[model samples]
Target: MAKILVVDDELGIRVSLWRALEFSGHKVTLAKDGEEGDRLFRENPTDLVITDLVMPKKEGLEFMSGLLVDFPDLKILVISGGGVKASSKDIELLLDTAQTRGAVKTFAKPFELHEILACVRDLLAADAD
Candidate 1:
């Protein structure tokens, strides 16, 4: 199983993601915000990062930028409640920025558990090369 880092400011979201990942047999790390996420990333290496788009400590895009700069091959998944469809310009920008930085997948909030699991599996499998 891949080691995953989940960064989100919402306590409920963090707990839910952690539980889901743990149930799927993946090693999971939870962070309250991007600052904590960065610190954890440095202290303990993770195979993939799953982060919320907008956060208080640091924006997810910024975190992804730094993480990608430090670890180019890093597989990342951007999750956002902001972008439901194509109309939300800010969400679109965030998604685009993350994609440019090497995020493998993007998931809109209220995402199904199966979808998240599938995305994680796909990303890790691809990384296995």
Candidate 2:
């Protein structure tokens, strides 16, 4: 089983991702914000990291940069809940930027849990090979 870290400012999101990772037979760790995420990451490296793009304290981009510096080959998935009324263009831009920053997959807010799980599975599987 792979070790996975879930990072999000929202408690609900962190729980949901944790459950999904557990159900998928992976070991999961939870971090409430980017700063905490970075701390945990430095302490114990995980096989993968799933983080929210927008958050309190340090943001996802900052976390990504730090991870790459410390763990160049670390795999990541980024999620963002841009807005209930955000323009499609803005959301696209955010996603594109995340992809450029080491995220193998980017999911928008209100996304299906299954979709996120699928991405996680795919990324982990790819890394295993």
Q: What would the per-residue lDDT of candidate 2 be over residues 16-44, giving only the tens digit for each residue? A: 88888899899999998899999998899
Worst-scoring 10-residue span by lDDT in model 1: 82-91
Backbone atom clashes (below 3 Å) for every candidate:
0, 0
C-alpha RMSD by candidate, in order: 2.4, 1.4
RMSD of 1: 2.4
Runs of candidate 2 with Cα error greater than 4 angstroms are 83-86
lDDT against the true structure, each candidate: 0.86, 0.87
lDDT (10s digit) by residue, model 1, range 27-103: 99999889999999999989999998788878898888899888988888998876345456667677777787778
Off by over 4 Å in 1: 83-87
Deviation of model 1 at 58, angstroms: 1.0
Against the hidden reference, what TM-scores do the models get?
Answer: 0.90, 0.93
